[model samples]
Target: DVRECLARAGLLLEGAPVLYLSGYKGGQVNPAKGDFVFNCSAIYELMPTDVRLCQPAIFSGKVLSALGSIIAGIGRPMTDAMGTCGKAGQSVPSSGGGNMFLVIDENDEITIGGV
Candidate 1:
């Protein structure tokens, strides 16, 4: 499995199919001819921990965007987070797999938290 391959390479990060801000020019570009790609030396990692109050929303960039929506959206350029100055889009270990917590307010708004 890719996870095992990564683990053997001393990479402990989780989550497969990590989003590629740039499909071709990007460093982690995967060729269509290959069945899988190993990223033992992936420079970017997922953010440490993130809590989403709303469902079906992705909070990767500055703004919150809907997930699996047909709306056309624009994204910012990816950066390295572990450089001399930390930048966004540079991967870090995800908090974990699954929702961390959920709360229902009196106003009926639902809140979700996850790493």
Candidate 2:
């Protein structure tokens, strides 16, 4: 899927460098209560794509990072990460939902990848 994703995005460029971060992101936010906390589990790697040898790799960064690096020279931050459940942890049942963004340098360690 990540390969297909990159292939679709046309980011399999030779001589182009890339940074990838894969992981889990979870936390709680309560604006009204003035409380906000979250976590980022970042898996980071930077490399060049061979296109021929590029496997799915399952890399995710919305192509924002790749595109930014390739086109604008600004690698977008990423996490492809998921979040914890519920608003203010109010629900009785445990579930998963919400959105969180995590950023890491190209070489930062701490990843969540591989299917």
Candidate 3:
């Protein structure tokens, strides 16, 4: 179902990725509050295909649900995709996480541009 969704959206890749980058984040955090290190991130994942094919507003929302189903089917805890937080020109220690190694073809919902 996920593959079908991506293919319909014209995002199914036919070759290996040209690049995959991450491990860096920069976003504003409040010192008065928890100063969460989220809402922003720097990730560049490029595949060997036409980048212009991404459908910004395709109908049907089955892609995300399908991906979630895959994660649930794994029956294993996911690792946290952690990062840093900064506020008042000072970096603060924080804690949070996300699942990794999810297998759902090209699920865009899980790849939103945010930390």
lDDT values of the candidates? 0.25, 0.38, 0.38
Model 2's TM-score against the true structure = 0.30
TM-score of 3: 0.26
Q: Write the residue-wise lDDT of candidate 3 on 8-62 in tens digits.
A: 5455467743222234444443335422232322333445443322222211224
Can you tell me which runs of candidate 3 are displaced by over 4 Å?
A: 1-12, 15-21, 29-45, 48-93, 101-115
lDDT for each residue of candidate 1 in 2-62, tens digit (9 for 90 to 100)? 2333344433344432221112121221234322222221222222232122222212211
True lDDT of residue 34, candidate 2: 38
lDDT of 2 at 3: 41
lDDT of 2 at 8: 50
RMSD of each: 18.5, 10.4, 10.3
C-alpha lDDT (0 to 100) for residue 10 of candidate 2? 58
TM-score (all chains, Cα) for each model: 0.15, 0.30, 0.26
Which of the two, 1 or 3, has more lDDT? 3
In model 3, what is the error at residue 54, expressed in angstroms? 17
